[model samples]
Target chain A: PSASAEAEARAHQTQLTKPAGSLGRLESLAVAFAGFQGCVKPTLERIVIRVFAADHGIAAQGTSAYPQEVTAQMLANFCHGGAAVSVLAGLLDADFRAVNLGCVGKVAPHKNLIDNTIASATADFSSAPAMTAERLSAALNAGFAQAQQGDLFIGGEMGIGNTTSAAALLAALFHLAPEAITGKGTGIDEATLARKTQLIGKALKLHRDQLTNPAAILQRLGGFEIAALVGAYIGSAQQGVPVLVDGFISTAAAAIAVALQPTLAPWLLYAHLSNESGHKLALNKLNAQPILALDMRLGEGSGAALAAGVVRQALALHNTMATFADAGVSHAD
Target chain B: PSASAEAEARAHQTQLTKPAGSLGRLESLAVAFAGFQGCVKPTLERIVIRVFAADHGIAAQGTSAYPQEVTAQMLANFCHGGAAVSVLAGLLDADFRAVNLGCVGKVAPHKNLIDNTIASATADFSSAPAMTAERLSAALNAGFAQAQQGDLFIGGEMGIGNTTSAAALLAALFHLAPEAITGKGTGIDEATLARKTQLIGKALKLHRDQLTNPAAILQRLGGFEIAALVGAYIGSAQQGVPVLVDGFISTAAAAIAVALQPTLAPWLLYAHLSNESGHKLALNKLNAQPILALDMRLGEGSGAALAAGVVRQALALHNTMATFADAGVSHAD
Candidate 1:
């Protein structure tokens, strides 16, 4: 982020026809964009959303309500442009891509699908580590390579029982109990939620020592798509493209990515606070205030996709609004 | 809101790719719109935003940071399409109108400007009732008249020191101390906020008995634009058009409107939670959950205008997104 561009944007905001700080978060959002883009007039004309699809081995433990096949099925839906994120991408005219980091079954090829499979599925963390270090690095590189040029980047995930993995990851990193950060994913009943919590507790205990290191944490407890999203966040920041972090799983990935590189924090904008019970706690740990809070718990970058319009408007207002002098309006005393 | 249309929308939601409650607030918002429009597929193609501009005589008590002249100045800014709300309305392609409920100085008229001036300015509420019963009724009628044909209605206000009046109204209605509901408006310093709080306390004491009645409360402590907005909310509901209420003053108006006719609550959608201190209390009193919480305090319907995009996308997704059967996707168990 360019300090000079941010300063210029702040000066320009004061000239806009409103009281200083009256626009509040919108003003800060535009200024942040200016800094991120290193231009006084930043525009969100091009948004690239990458939905990383994988299957979590934890699903075998009855941690999620849906079958693991749903992961590959949803990936197919993304390819067919029949998913919520697909519709939202069209609404924002954003470039949407489905990156198959890993899936248990074969995923049919599509023009918009990027096949970068590291493994068919992760190992169930309740019994063992999710992935090897080599596989984790491969997943990270795949996401880093897919971080193409765009005005903004959004990373979403799709994996059955991935919330279990995310909860374990957050519990390990934040050193909190599994029950404190466990939530029902895909609308599970009370029994399933309780079982999921127990499984996460076991996983956290299994990876307790390894949790001290970020790379070890990802290798031991994170799914392929989770690692990919972490890499995507870091890669987007490296490429000077800001990333809009999605819901719980994505935010968990962000916590790992930012832990590895604190500088990436400035490049990340939380899109929404999910309805998932753990989301607020995870977001608080990352010191993020998301743009929307519609209690949306759906993953697949849908929340981030919805927020794209708000970011676009912030840019539009920043670039197009006439100054007080231009409008002949009186300045605040 | 039509129950049959809402039921159809809910059934369609279950047929979508995600879980029944996965989309959370988005699902409820879409269902609410479907019910409001009395159709399974509701569209937000036409949005009408009315920004009521009026001067507050309370500015004479040093209750605000800006001079009262800013009320008329911002009205011109809105007419010139240079204000925050104006830029946001243009971004959303919503029809924007600046209704001059009352301004101290002459405002050059435009086609979009509604000349409904009931008074040059309201009396200083710190000393006396802001408006006569007759003037209050006229202001309400003007707002009611502007609630014409549109898929969605947004009511915003631009009145200097009106927060004082809003706080006084809320304090009188809720039987709370003025300090609890008063906040810094338009970036006031500590001293100014203290002074504003004291003035509101005085006004509340003077209007204690009249505040028991909603109409009397408006006449005693509301600005012309506030009364007009209260009327607009009621009129829009009476006309079967859902209204999106904006910020502190707008919420105050909504409180009065809902108090007068509790049925109007179903016809209102809160746009955003403002940074003002009393806004949350007012919204809680009405049992309303706003769509956005950007800490925005810039009146003129800017928050509502920004939220227009979100509502439009919700409508678009509800109408266009393919169902699980249509898209050949499997549903959850």
Candidate 2:
């Protein structure tokens, strides 16, 4: 009965103002939205982006390819309209909002911040994760309510050492060992990579029970930002708007949303495959195929945002191109 | 003087109703039009596609990646709109015209044939090339005069086992060994690659004198279609219409065009970087950067034609996008 809603969405998708299936992936996305909303002509109006950002205790472990400060720096850049996502969101005509779900001690609210502090990142998972379940849910609810107006919502994450957390969480969820999921996050080398993998292995043992519960798994190993993204994902589907799943970390959150409510998978459109090895696992878990395959690893919803541009073109082309019948070009081979 | 004319034509690429430089490669192409005519606001009207098609004598050598008949069959597909490029050009509003500069005996002309039946293809260089220098030049001249009214010209080629011909020609021209220039055309495997490289080595020895002149090069190892593309490139430059260079074979022709008159190089814009290894070498020789890098191996100007869409987007974006001041958005951080 639940699958029927997405199916209804799909039927409406083929009936859009274009030749059948002409827009390619965009047609699929429109169909996905139809399924999510259970509508024939799903609206994608009032687009909103809920960007969840946090700090990772794993940064103390020196796990990231970039310095931990970059997470805070980029978040500020997003607020100041100087980031790639800021420029791209302008290109996409999407409303861009960033929430400091958790960061190092609550800083003053910036222009993009729709939600205040959840905590300054998770506790260094090497000891114990920094957050409790209540904080994660509060942050999630705040971001979700802010996204209520949009018929399409996109969620992104900004956290130092988040990939380490994402890889650890994916390894546990998929029942694979760490190395299989870990990758050069922000471009680390052999020695640092080995340690990063080991740290995740150690964290799993410390938080086994919490890791079993999908929400608990997020709190146990995911960044506050990642957990908020999961909440946003779940909330968007509950609101009947299509939600675009960004790169690997966002996918990690998405996988949690799907696990909690299996029907949520129908609402998500994967933007692009990442250079992250864990992303392939996430895609496999969600049964999703992304549009672009360029080896992009940068996050900040850039993949999803860029992919939106392609999808917009696809829809326009699908809707605008004259069919053989209308063009009067003889169809005779 | 010829170089200046081509450069000026390139500079005048169409205004496309977008900001100048907003669409990058497309803007460059619009500029190519100005460079072509040495004027402003160049039109992309009256497109001419000089498809230099030739059957390689090497098809008999059984050293190609794909079967020889695939070439002739593919050419038939091109005329019938079953080939990808045929669909692409139609999609992009570019008028497509294929030429049969050379092919095997008794090859019939098809609907898209702009120039038909120049020769049945070059003779195997391993034996003696099929045509003399005078014959190659005559066929090339025929193609040059085929499309007199076109505002732009792009060269494409179809030849079974033609990569072997290309490698042999390149090897001879640069005085490099055959292996340095050979590639898996149409997907030949490792052992076959070795045999093909060995065969090219033998042909180079026999065709050494052919390197002395461009016509002699065509007579010795280059395909009849390639020679036609060379002439078409020159003719497009002469007529002040930009020339679009397709994959390896077309670039080979462009190489000959540039060698004959260095100024003709300015009249060309690379459409795609084909899956062939020799393509990069040719691009390096011309010092050109392709617009798209989608791992496209299906040649027939599919890459170039698809790139036409991107170029169009670039032009539209350039001409249409509101500058920061116009959009009322802050340009500074």
Candidate 3:
């Protein structure tokens, strides 16, 4: 990020026709974009969204509302432009694709679906580590490759029991109890939620020693898609592209990525506060303020896609609105 | 609104590829538009933005940060495509215009500027009624005339001390003290805000008996732009067009419009929660849930224009997204 460019943009905002600071967070967002783009006026014309789909062995423990096969089904849906993110990507004219990291069910090939499978599914974390170190490395490399392009990057995840993995990851990283961070995955009832929490609690205890570091915690409790998301976030920021982080599971990835590389924090913008109960607590841990709060919890980059429109509007107003001198309007006395 | 269409849309949302209620407010927003358009799927293609510029009588009390001449200056800015709303409307491709209800300074003729002058300005409400019944009626009719076209209507106000007028009207209608509803207008200092609050308190006491109904309170304390907003809101709903109400001033107008005709509430959607302290209280009194809360306090329908993009996205998803059967995806089990 360019500090000088951010300073220049902030100074320029005061001269706009409207009252200074009246545009609120939008003014700050424009300034931040300017810094990221290293220009006074930044544009987000080319947006890229990559939805990583895999299966979590945690689903075998009955931690998800949907069957594990839904992951592969959603991948096909994404490729066919039927998923939430797919529809949004079409409307936004975004460069979008689905990466099949690994799923329990077979996914058919399509132009928009990228094959980057490491395993059919991760091992169930309740009884064992989710992935071997080599599998984790391959997944991270796959995600990192996707972050090579686009003006803005949005990383979305699809794994049936990913929320359980994310909750366990956050609980260990934040040093919180499982009950505090665990939430219903898709739409689990009270009994399932409690069971999910208990399962995560047991997994945390089983992997307490191995959870000493971010990557170790991720290997022990994170799903393949989540680790990929973490890799993508780091790569996007390294390439000087801002990443718009999605909901609960995606935020968990961001948390790990930022923890691993603190400098990467500046390049990630949270999209929205999700319907998941732990999302707020997770966001607070990172001191991140999301763009919208429509109570959305769909995990296919939809929230981030929705926020892309807002960020575009912010940049448009910044780049096009006339200054006080141009408008011949009086400034505050 | 067609209740049957709304119900149909709600059911249709459940059949889409995502989980039920996963889209949160977007789902309900699409359902609401379905009702308003009287179709299972609705579109928001033609958006209309009308900014009413007038001078407030209470500027005589030094309640605002800018001079009263700014009312006319902003009218020219709006026409020249330099103001915040002008830039937003241009980006949104909205049908945009500025209506000059009444201003202390003379405004030049422009293609996008409509002349509807009722007086040089209203009487100082601190000493007398802001506008007579006849002038109020004329202002409302002028605003009503602007609401005849477009799929959606957005009413914006541009006046130096209209927040003072809005605050006073809200206080009178809600039977609250000025201290409860008064806030800084365009970045007023502590001294100016305190003086503004006390001035409104005295004005309310002076008009205690006459502030009986919504219209009486409006005539006694409202600016011409605010009254026009009220008319535009009512007019838009009457014409079967939905109205996206702007910030504090616009919400105040919506409050009066909804109170006068309770059925008008269904056609109105709150755009954003303003940074102004009184905006939340006013919205709550009207049972409004604004779509965004970016801490924006700029009037002139910028917030509504920003929200139009989100609404359009929602409708697009509703009208085009494939159902579970189409995607061949399984439902939650």
C-alpha lDDT of all candidate models, in order: 0.88, 0.66, 0.92
Spell out the clash pairs found in candidate 3. none
lDDT of 1 by residue, A1-333 (tens): 999999999999999888888887888999999998898999998899999989888888988777788888888888787888988999888888999988887788999899998888999888999999899999999888878789999999999989999998898888888889999988899998999888888888777777888889888999999999998899999999999999999999999999899989999999999999999999999889999898898899999999888888888888888898898777767
Q: Relative to the unseen true structure, what is the C-alpha lDDT of residue A9 in candidate 1, on a scale of 0 to 100?
A: 98
The DockQ-based CAPRI class assigned to model 1 is medium
Across B1-333, the per-residue lDDT of candidate 2 in tens digits comes to 234644553443221211122223444554555445555444454565545566877778877644554555556556666444665566656778776665653344767865556556667778887578687778678667754666667667777777787777666665677766688776677988888998888777776655686566767887777777777778877766676677777777777778788877666888767667777876886798875554555455655665555444333333333333332222211
Looking at model 2 chain B, report the run of 10 residues with the lowest lDDT sum.
B13-22
Task: Output the lDDT of residue A202, model 1.
Answer: 81
TM-score of chain B as predicted in candidate 2:
0.86
Model 2: CA > 4 A from native:
A1-47, A105-108, A149-151, B1-333
Residue by residue across A197-227, what tens digits does model 2's lDDT show? 9998888888876677777777778777877
For residue B163, what is the lDDT in candidate 2?
Answer: 76
Compute each candidate's TM-score over C-alphas: 0.97, 0.59, 0.99
Interface RMSD of each: 1.3, 11.2, 0.8
lDDT of 1 at A332: 68
